[model samples]
Every structure is written in C-alpha cells, then in structure tokens.
Target chain A: MWFKYIMVKLVLQNVSTLRGIVGVLNDILKEAKFKMTNDGVHMSATDPAKIIMIVLDIPRTGFDEYICEKEVELGVSIEEFYNVLKRANKGETVQIENIDNKLKIITTGKVTREFVLPLIESIEDAPKITTGEFSAKIVAETDIIVTAIDDASIISDELVFKATQGNFEVAAKSEFHSTNLNLIKDKLIDLNVKESAQSTFSIDYLRRIFATSKLAPVAELNISTNHIGKFSFSATDMFRMYFLLAPRTTD
Target chain B: MWFKYIMVKLVLQNVSTLRGIVGVLNDILKEAKFKMTNDGVHMSATDPAKIIMIVLDIPRTGFDEYICEKEVELGVSIEEFYNVLKRANKGETVQIENIDNKLKIITTGKVTREFVLPLIESIEDAPKITTGEFSAKIVAETDIIVTAIDDASIISDELVFKATQGNFEVAAKSEFHSTNLNLIKDKLIDLNVKESAQSTFSIDYLRRIFATSKLAPVAELNISTNHIGKFSFSATDMFRMYFLLAPRTTD
Candidate 1:
C-alpha cells in the first residue's frame, strides 16, 4: 500500500460534539482511538460517556516533513484542524504542518480561511463503562435485515438485539408503536450463538451508523445488558467506534 | 420548462429594523422582485442598510411530479408537499404542483425538514419606502463605485456619501473613530443630484451582507439628507428595496 499520511489522531466525544455542525461527523466516528506518530495528529478528547481516538493519516506521504512529537497531554486543537480540513473534500490535496504552536492546513482548491484550533487540557473524564460476558456475532445476512431493523428502530427510543436458538431478531414495541425486524442466518453468513441474550440500547446512539453511510462498508457490533456496546465499520478505510450507554431500569 | 413544485410562499416586512438579514439581497439584485408563481418561489432576504441578500429559489423540476393552480397564501403548512421537496438543492430536480387543497412536491434527495415563510399580513409592518427624485436611470459608466475605507470614522456610528460636481465619497469621523471608504467614477453613468445631498447612516445595517453575497450582481443606490435611501438592482427581474434611517447628530 502506498504510504500517504504518517500521523494519527483520536477523536473524543465533547470536543467533537462542541465542534460538529450539522451533526454528521459525530455519529459516524463516535468512540474511537487514533494513533499518529509522524503522519497527522495524535490526540484525544471526550466528555462523560464516550472516548474517541482520531488519526490524521493521508493516503499519501510527505507528512513526516512537518510532524512533531509531543506528549499526549498536549491536546491537538481538533476543532481548528477539523474546520480547516472541513473545507477540503475526500481526495483533495491538503498539507498540514505544525508551525509555531499553530497547526497550519493548506488545501489545494480555492484557498480556504486558515483555521486555528486552540490547544487545551484534554477533558478525558468520562463515566467508566465496562461490560462483562458478551458473546454473539451475526454477520449481516442480507440487506433487508439491516434496513428493516434500522427503520423499525426509528420510531422507538430503544432497541433489542436478541440472539436465540436459531433466530436472530432486532425488535421494539410501544402502545401505539411496534416493530419486529428479523434475520435468518442459515442462508447467509456464519452464525455462532448458544444462550439467548436480549439487550436494549438508546436508538440515539445506534443512529451513528447512518451518518457514516458513505464510508461504512462492514459493521461489527458487540453488545450486552448493563454497559455500553461497540459498533465498528470498515468502508474505504478501517474505522473502529464504540458507544457506552447505561441500560434503562426494567419495569 | 417542465413544471413541478409542492408549495410557493411569500414573506414581506412592514416593520423596518436597523439591521435585518434580507437587506443584503437588495444590494445584489437591485430591482428584482421575488416571484412566487406555480412552479416554485424565489426571494432575497437582506439587511436594512444594504449589504447582502440571502437569495433562495426552489424550482419545480427539483420535486418528484405534481401540478395544480390556486391562490397562494402564507404561514399555513402544506406539510406533505413541503416534506417531499424540502431537500431540493440550489439546482436540483423539482416537480411541484397543487391538487385540490393539498400541495405535492417530489424531491430527488432525502429530506429532514421543510421551511415556510410568513406572509405580508402576518409580518410586522415596515417603513413605507417610496420612489425618490434620483430614482430614475444612471449612465452605466459613472454610476458604480465602491471603496473599502481605513480608520477614519472609527468611532462615528454614521458615514457620509457626499456628491460634489461629479464625484462621490463615503466619509466618517469621530473622536473615537475617523475613517473613510471612498470610490470615485466619472467617465459615464450620470447621477441626478437631488439638490446635491449627503446622508449619514449606520454601518450595523450594512453588516448583514455576510449572508447574501450572490443576488447583487449589479445594483443602483440612492442617498438623501435624512439617511433614507433606495437600492435597486435589476435586469429581466425587477426589485425595489427601501432603507430608512435617521441621520446621526455627529456634531
């Protein structure tokens, strides 16, 4: 593979939320860790419930010319960098350099305004989310399964992904609302599951996938009963993200 | 052209403010009137002192497919029609039409929400702006001039556009601020001096141009002693924008 970007960056919850306009980027990237040594930026930011790591590595090289090594405590100005790169498109040429404590990003097309991301202490104090035993991996069997389930969850605030003896179903119900989205894996991918486990999570968090639709080629989700779960996708590039949500009390 | 549209709306202001978003639109497309016909709607919102205009136009072809004819009103929600065509981009395919009391708008892309503008009756009354003595025509050559001034009237809340012989200059001065932005032109387009007048107006009203950088491709402006001016920009489309202001007592 041709080396493009040499550095990496980790995106956090609060910094991204505070800066994410139109709310598109927040949903797609979510909780992830990005490591950058000489390519892009190696930094992290978060709030109470999410942890995100962002890596700013280009598909090409020349980043080492400007990369600077600093302790993790020297938080990267995610907002400024994002705004600078925000003017750029996917394949456009962008050169990022650390000049005099300021990150300078230059895009190829119409010269966009210089963005300045202020360096501040990383707000890394989020709620500790830890889950115990979780076992269930059902490769997306068909397109219909993901679509139906995703749609059904739209109206309800929570969703239940259950893996039983031979059937795997994602469902939701309410007085005036009810949705049953199912998937039969015998005809599709490899399915491995023993005991039945049904857990509910906020659809608000689950909606993150739709935001990254352009880049999400594959999705691997890990779930449980009490703590947060993980949802990851690999599109043109590899992306790993997680969401830790506390389950609601049963009635 | 192929016809289509969901709804067409018109909003007018009777209460004139010192600074409003729509004022900028008048500066761009000088004498252009917002046309709300069967196909779609087109109007520019500007600030009162004439800086920019937020010009929004949704064509009928951008919608799916629908058509009908009826009297258009304001504020009422044509939800179904609005929802369908809300995602229409600047140059998207639209098909909007009226059927009975319902409006049908078919949009090419997915829509999250719709926008509706209020009508003339519902909006607060604005100043009654009328045609002035120099409201005639100007010779193309000598009529257009704009200059970005430096620290002259830095503290003064007003600027003066004085016409002498055949030249015009914008000047401002005060203890805290003294600056002038002047533009000179004299080859052609002639100005009819309404008794050779000068007026002082607030710069705050001119800041709204940030929203509208498009509509005012070519425009004509008017100035008087009382700080009341009329700005017009037109070709095939016609519009007359009025700006009312009290002259600053900068003695």
Candidate 2:
C-alpha cells in the first residue's frame, strides 16, 4: 500500500540466450534473444524434447502488490529473480502487479522477501551495445568444419576451428590424446576446403549460436587463419561475445 | 584408442542444501570451472560479483598410463568428457587424472565446495543409543517464534517446525514475506537445552535449519508433548536429508 517509486510508460525489447546449451531454450535465452519490456521480460520458448510452448513473464519492478480484492500474492526482484525464474517449473505460479507506482512479484512454494528497487529510465540506449561491422558471409569450402569442430570440441577445452581455400577442420589437443576431424564435403553448411580463415570461439557461445538453427539460422563459413572473432546478440539485453586464439599453427 | 562409457566421481555429503544452492554452482561451473577427479572433487571459489567459484578436474581414468616412459597426450572420450565436465565450467580447460585406483581432482580457482555431512546411522541410533526424556536449549527463542508468524510469512506455503520444551526449535516455511532468519541462523552454534522430550520438524528440507551452522549440533530439550519427530541424514552422501513431522496431539 505504501508507494516508493513511479515511472512513465516506456517499452523496450528483451532477449537473452544461454552461453552454453543443454537444450534449445538455454541457447536462445542466454545468447541471441535478449529482451526487456515495460511490463517485464518474457521468454516465449518451445521445449525441443516435449515440443511444448512456454511463455514466461517477469515484471519490471521487484515488489509485492496485493489486491485486498482477490486473494493472490506474487513477488520478484531484479538482481536474483531472473536466476530463480530460470530454474523454476514452467507451470509454477508466478505473480506480478503494479500498486500505486510500486511493482510486486511473488513465486509459489518459495519464501518471499520484498526488494524495492529504484525505477530508472526504461530507455533503450542504456543497455550495453556492440559496435563493429561483421562480415556478411563466408563460404565453408568443407561441410565438416563446424561439425568436426563441435565434435572435437566435445573433448578439448577450446575448439580450434580452421577454414581456408582447400580445407576446414576443428581440433583439440590434450596430454592424453589429440582429436582432429576434417570436413571435406557439404557446401551449404560446411564448405569443403583445407583451410581459409580461422577463429577460436567459446564452445559456450557456439552452443548458443547453434541454438538458432531453427531461427535466424547462420550459414556455415570456414576460418582460414586463427584469429579472435566477435559476435553480438540483441533482444532484451545486448551481448558482445568474444573468442580468441592464434591460428592452428601445427595442424 | 579404445573407448568405454564415461563415468566421473563426485562426492558431496548433504543433499539438503542441494535443492537451493547447487543451481548456483551450476551457473558458475558452466564457464568458471570444469573437470573431475579420482580422489573426489575439487575447485576454486571467489568473491567476484557474479562469479562464485571456478571448478576444474580430470577423471582418474583420463590419465594415460600407456605412455609411462614419455610425456604422453591425454585422450578423453568425446561425449563422455563433455557430458561430465559441461556440468562444471562452460569455457575453461578441464583436466582430470587417476593415479593407481583413486582419482585425484584438481582445478584452477578458489575451492569453495566444502562441508561436513552427518550420517543418520551415526547420528540416529544413539547417544550410544539416544535416550529419551530431556531439555532443549536455544540462544533466542523469541526471535524465531515471533518472527516466524509475522506477515512476511503469509506467503510461506509450508511452515513445518518441531520443538521440544527445552531442547530446540527448527522451522522452515516456503511462503512470501517469510521469516526464515531463525531456520537458517548461521550465527549461533549450540543451544544448551538438552532435555530430550519431544520435537516436531518440517517435511521440506530445503529450508535450512541453521545457515552454515553445525549439523546435528545436539541441543537439550524438555519433551513433554505427544508427537514424534525425526532428523535423518546419510553419512556417506550427506546429500540426501529428511525431516519428518510428528503430529503433537498433546502438549
């Protein structure tokens, strides 16, 4: 009932993608689709396994607003709330409301603590942005490039993706054994080649990029020389993901 | 090389906290740490704003003994290695080794996953055979009892608690505006009320009985009530914990 902060209506997009993926949603929410709206942030996802559509809503403010009217209680906070919701059951009760100027949130089956945050300008410019021209496209001479890298990536700490005029490959080295796979076929996704360009990316973000296989799909490209590369994603939030490495000098 | 199903060893005692805290570790390890060990598990923890710990390790079987005379490269199963370590760090290099029969786990970063677990067999069947009739002690009973019933607890779905006249009072409630300060009072250690009479406990174990406090720290109690209570824990994998409620028809 006590009012703390007020704000004018402002709407913005929210998107996020998981840096690493156990599933598709993790990839979409944490990496590519970062969004934030006036009402709050929402994640509209479909479980690849069950193939069930999920619509999740998180209010903008972190407070509990109750209607002495209908008997319902909900709570949420900005800092840790998202982390909690990320793990909550899709169908669990999630509550949010605007009382006077304060917003309240609540989640079922968990204790609640009211956190009143100062509502700031819900402007679009405040979010971190990535400003760099990215290459429009590249031809993967070999189709096995990404698959090989991702496959070998399953064993090594980092994926050494190499692409060039004639060959493309992904490889990982360990004290016990080194894994290297070649991509000599397929031009749609992987270009048949020995090597053209090179870049080292976090398997985490790569996992996310792969998540978009169903949407905003990215075509394959072979990295010829090992060079650090960058990628950006915008939705509710903006991200600048970086991958670094010297070209695969040996292989 | 030969391949076999991948198996990693992880030993964590105390499953009670896993319901709430392990998720946090899941996030940090995704990029912060990776690896497994033959000896057990090891990692590094830190106070960096969002990051809590960095875990790293290798499986005991990962160590290649065939190249004993020379510095040999380590060979790890693709999916097996990825599946095991993916649960830890998302982007970091992870190494694991097995010497002899035991696995030795090591990682790069602050080691934080550490705790002592109480086994039910060791804690249950005895005070050399636990006796009945007693008094339970507490540091500040008013704080726990009063704060428990406040409006903050209105959203607390379950208020499961058990207490004896003199021994101890433990409560866990999953509701909004909840009063959990006492249930997880990380401050106090042993409350001297040891007049063991009767006690009531909560069913949900996610609610911490005492925050980072001692587990099974014996307290005296004056059990005069007609209710049965239980505190069950495993010695080997303190991970699985349970508290049963005994309806107190008579006080």
Candidate 3:
C-alpha cells in the first residue's frame, strides 16, 4: 500500500505586503478564492456588479517558509481576512496553517494573537479577464495617481484619464466643481502613447484601486481606447496585484 | 463721546490639544458654549441624555498670544468645529479671531487655510457640575486606562472601578466574558482610599473620555461610592479636561 501525506503551511516574515493586498481585495470583492500550490498562492475575484476584477499572485519566494505537499484551494471572506491581518504589526511575521476546515493565523508582535477563520465555498467559475494590447501605457508614482484620484473624487463621480504626447492628465468635471491633475513626462517614469487615448471611469473604482498604493511605490497603467484599463502594482519580489476596470461612456 | 472696544483673539502653538478637546465634546454634545476671558477659554457641555458632562479649560499661558479686551461668549457646533480643526496639521499654530458674527480660524502650516464658522447664541445658563469629595482618588497613566477601557468594552457594556488600600482595578463582567486590569501602587502616581469603594459606569461614557487621552499623559480619577465618578485628563499646564459620569448599579 502507498500513501501520500499532505501538508500546507505558509509563513511570511513581513505581513505589510499581505495586508496591503488583502485591503484592496476586500474593497473590491466580498469573497475571494485562494489557490495554494508548491509554487505559491494565487487569488482572484470580481466585484458583484462585475465592473472590476482583481488578481493577486505571490510566489513561494515571497514567504519566509512555504511548505506544500499537495495543492489546496481555500475560500475566504476577504473582509474578515483583512480584519485578522490588521491585528498583526507592520513588521511582525504571520504564520498561516490549514487546520481541518479553518485557517489558523498566528501573529507574533508585542503579543501573539491567534485567530481561526472558517473557510467558505470557493467560487469554482470565476470570470477570466483577458489582457489585450493597449494604446497608452504609462508608469508613474503611486502617490501621484492616488492623490489625483482623491482630488477628482471630491468634484465628480467619474474621472477621465487622458494620455497625449508627453503628458497624462486626470480630470473630473461636475456642475459645481472641476479638478484637473497633469503629470508631465519629466515626472513620470515612462509614458507611451501610440495615438493619444482617453477613457472615463468611475471614481469609486479608481479609489479602490489606489487602496493598494502602500504595497508598491509605483503603478504601471495599461489603458485601451474605450474598453478596459489595467493597473499593475508590484512590490519588489514579494507580491503583485492587478486591477482591471471597465470603462464608462459619458452618454 | 465714550467708546468701548472688544476684541477676542487667541493664537496657540499647536492645535492638537484644541482638536482633542473638541473631539470629545462633539461626541457628548451637539452644541457647546465657549467663554473667553482674561484668564483663558472655558467650555462645557452635557450629553443629550444628561448621563455625562465634559468641561474643558485652557489657561491664557497656554496660548502663544491671548488678546481679550472684554469677556466674550461664542456658541459653536462641536462637530463643525472639530471638522474644521481636523484640516490643521498636528503642530500647526491656529489663530482664532472673533470677526463680527463668525469665528475665523487660520491655520499656518505648509499651506495657510482660513475657515469661517458662524457663531450662534451662547447658552447662558449651562449646568455647572460641582466637584465633591470622593472616597478614593487614583492617578495613573492615560494609556493604561485607555487600553483597559477598550479591552473592557469588547466584553461588557459597563466597567467597574474599585480602589483598595494600594491597588486600583478596572474590570468588566458580562454573561459571556470578563476582563480585569489591576494597577498597583507602584504603577500609579498616587492612590488614596479612605475607605474601599467600588463603582460601575457605562463603558460608552468611558470610551468617549478616553478619546482625549492623546491630550494628556496621566489621568486622575475621583470615585465616589456608587454615586458619580470624575476623570481629569490634563496636559502639562496647557489644558485640562474633566469628565463626570453617572454610575450604574450592577444589580
């Protein structure tokens, strides 16, 4: 007789990246599915209205200790997971263990905290988002984008992103007020505009995307004419988050 | 011809203390009455339910510049005042000038911001709380008290304070859980108990009182057996806040 033993445990030295990723996911989706394998962990979810989809991938090298004998899929409530992760200090290590049907989270800081979260049913058929060629690709500091989104949110519900020659402008207009933030080529790390593309999106979605600004110093933007826009935020070699947002037309 | 001139203006080195005091008042009461005299500024308010009363006093010496030709009383919405002050940086100097019917607040920091708040009719006869002799008096670090209150709040709706010869204890007991925090003589600056006394008060009131912990380092507690309790949180000689809470019977 032959038997195979299965062990699934992951320990991360710093929880800041995980916390930042979970914070953004909780804002976009209610429930998220995590796939843990020998390689690493992958999670993705779409908003209820299907306006946005988020994908998170963390390689095995991201964690201090990653042990997996067999692949396992865990369904979790993102909000609850974020709340539990919040209990860990910025520099503290977090140890996660698969216990029967619950996830055991052990955070070591000034005091060790143990939290057990019940697993939910994973979404078997999550919508797959395809990456296509874009007309404009811009790379800028995350802080600049976050600040622009925040300023635009105060004036209108919709924000327009326009990339022209050597300049990327974020603008919002309403009956009462209007705000415009212009990022010149000198300020941005990279700017590529094939034919000058502009798209309008809901400020609500953009604000949620900026929630992960702490995870990375900069964000790479891939903007298509009028279909979809993608923002990729990556931190060193620890984690990478992708936010896909659907464009809105001003009718 | 005889003319009388009245001018009331106060400039503080930092708005943090003022912000903390206003934050506590806004939670307890909707409107507050501020009286400015040669000595300083005094404000007090009672909760809508009359379960708690808060008093705030800032001496003239606390302000960088205090100019008051005649005593003036201004009625303000505590929430609005707090919201305006929130725009000021932590260490930014705030200049408050009574201009006709509005209070002008100028904050000097990275950017100068000016906000005008309309003054309303002052509450002429605000209820005055008399400080009575208490059976037990204890002084301890504000952080310890605040943490204990936060911990107790998670377990019960009421917290009991008991002071014996050399120990001060804060405990919360509920049907589901109980939490006790004891501060011995070594940990406290002063602990006096003429006779052992115990009192229970609503955790809701205690939590609001602790919101001002950032304004002071130590908090002085005056406990009168089963009657009322007063907590005085003072920051150096700049400001002092007093919170009087009505006790509840466990039975």
lDDT of model number 1: 0.42
- Using lDDT as the measure, which candidate wins? 3
User: What lDDT would each prediction earn against the true structure?
Assistant: 0.42, 0.34, 0.83
Candidate 2 chain B — worst ten consecutive residues by lDDT sum? B118-127
lDDT of 1 by residue, A1-251 (tens): 31232232332212222123213344433332333454333323343244332222222132323343542233443333444444444444555444443334443332221233334443443334446656665555334445655776667877777776576777888888888876677743645565566677666655544343334434555555443455544323223333334454456
Q: Rank the candidates by TM-score, best first.
A: 3, 1, 2
Mark the regions of model 2 whose C-alpha exceeds 4 Å error after superposition.
A1-83, A93-105, A108-147, A153-156, A165-168, A173-195, A201-226, A231-251, B1-251
Name the 10 consecutive residues with the lowest summed lDDT in model 1 chain A.
Answer: A13-22
Residue pairs in collision within model 3: none
Residues B1-251 of candidate 3 have per-residue lDDT tens digits of 11133267889877777777888888888887888999999887788898998888999988899988788888888888899989888768899888777888999978888999988885655687776789999998887787667656654688889999998988776543355667778878899999899999998889888887877888999997797899998876788888899899856
Compute the lDDT for candidate 2: 0.34
DockQ-wise, the better of 1 and 2 is: 1
lDDT of 3 at B185: 89
Chain A vs. native, model 3, TM-score:
0.92
DockQ-derived CAPRI band for the predicted complex in model 1: incorrect
Task: Name the best candidate (by TM-score).
Answer: 3
TM-score of B chain for each model? Answer: 0.53, 0.23, 0.92
Candidate 1: regions farther than 4 A off: A1-35, A39-84, A89-92, A125-133, A141-150, A153-155, A186-190, A225-227, A236-238, B1-251
